[model samples]
Target: MSRQLLQEPVQDLLDALTKSEGPDILSTFTTSPKPLAHEHGLPQLAPFLGRSFHGQEGISAYFDLLSTYLQIENMKFEPEETWVIDESCMAIALRGTATFTWKETQHSWEETFAYRIKVAEDVSDDSEKNGSLKVCEYQIWADTGAAYLASLGNLDDMPE
Candidate 1:
């Protein structure tokens, strides 16, 4: 039987995110005519936290920061739940794991995280109806405490 509407595209997006560069991550987002298409966007954690990363450039920069400071390995998804947002649309909360490192301190940890992925509403050039999921917004629920301590160069050394 054919795959479900979300399974295939979401999987593709997750795979794209695992690439060694940010363009692949950018490619998964919805298209826009003007700049700042994403006026308000994701990630509510230290390092990538705050509202500074608003548009495509900001999003790209976010990835740049990640590349500069953090390392992700063996990225994979463990589906937890999927729910509808509206007709012909849905969102997912899934568990993800990766070996994350703070490149500055050469500190690494096995992290289990999550994402609240919201499907992009309108991306004329790259429509999700064509079977590719376009992301509008996603909130990352990662190990911020570890990342915070990692940024300080003592993640493992911190008290339990």
Candidate 2:
């Protein structure tokens, strides 16, 4: 597939999340009963923060955890680099910025993200088809200290 075609699903997912459309966000995944891994790379701030999730259930749990602290108004993802690993796989390096209400205080954050996505084959059987291109792995690296302080509504402690 072309790069533009490969990027469409990812862009769709980002758009849905930016709009806070939960159902649309969830539809970008495959329902193959396989495990999907998502890792958040901030741990020192909150105990429940920066956890790794697996499978659809784990994905739902991760979203639930995020909803408690983050009321995101907008999330914009810009692909800084992209590499096609093969016909069925691709990796995208993204720089993302978001404006959100965290812990009742509005804040904005910028992060570097990486996504490894796999394009599912079009099989005849519904059960056999894995659906569309789905994000198999997502990793985020951000300023943990700032995000931590924001989560506590302590803007004064945040670095300049």
Candidate 3:
């Protein structure tokens, strides 16, 4: 029932990722163009560079660029919130799923990532954009599902 036990599956991966602030995350990748991108630190993206691919690389790249453009000030995990620890130490990945979609608006992109956050309250409906989900980044990063859970309880100013 501990945090470590619950994070067993994506514990190391997500932990390593989340530990780095968004600005730090941007610096590491933006300057390099290609670095330890995957969970295993693989350089497989170079070969597929000129080619077209729709995966984490593109999305991560977009985030990096967006972070740079926004001049993000700070990035930190929700400190005071309660993490959904598992009932047992030897349980599966105590994480949920998320989906993101973006569309080209008049002058910029309108992006939204829907999530199924596991909060203390029954907020399945509150995760929607119109609900209690706190949006970020000129409302471009408006998340409605697990993203809300991932970003829960964090009180940093908008990244701008």
Which candidate should be chosen as best, given TM-score against the real structure? Answer: 1
Pairing residues by index, what is the TM-score of model 2? 0.71
Clashing pairs in 1: none
Q: How close to the true structure is residue 9 of candidate 1, measured as C-alpha lDDT?
A: 45
TM-scores, in order shown?
Answer: 0.72, 0.71, 0.26
List, residue by residue over 53-82, the lDDT tens digit for candidate 3.
223365356455334332222222332133
* lDDT at 144, model 1: 73
Q: Candidate 2's residue-wise lDDT over 25-138, tens digit each?
A: 455555554435454555677544577766567766767777877665556666425443444455555566665556666655554444455534333246544445655555
User: Which run of 10 residues does model 3 get worst, by summed lDDT?
Assistant: 132-141
Candidate 3 Cα RMSD after full superposition onto the native fold (Å): 17.1
Candidate 2 — worst ten consecutive residues by lDDT sum? Answer: 116-125
Flag clash pairs in model 3.
115-145, 115-146, 116-145, 116-146
**lDDT of the candidates, in the order given:** 0.61, 0.58, 0.27
Candidate 2 wrong stretches, greater than 4 Å:
20-23, 33-37, 79-88, 104-131
Question: In candidate 2, residue 137 scores what lDDT?
Answer: 52
By lDDT, who's the top model here? 1
Candidate 3 local Cα displacement, residue 106, angstroms? 20
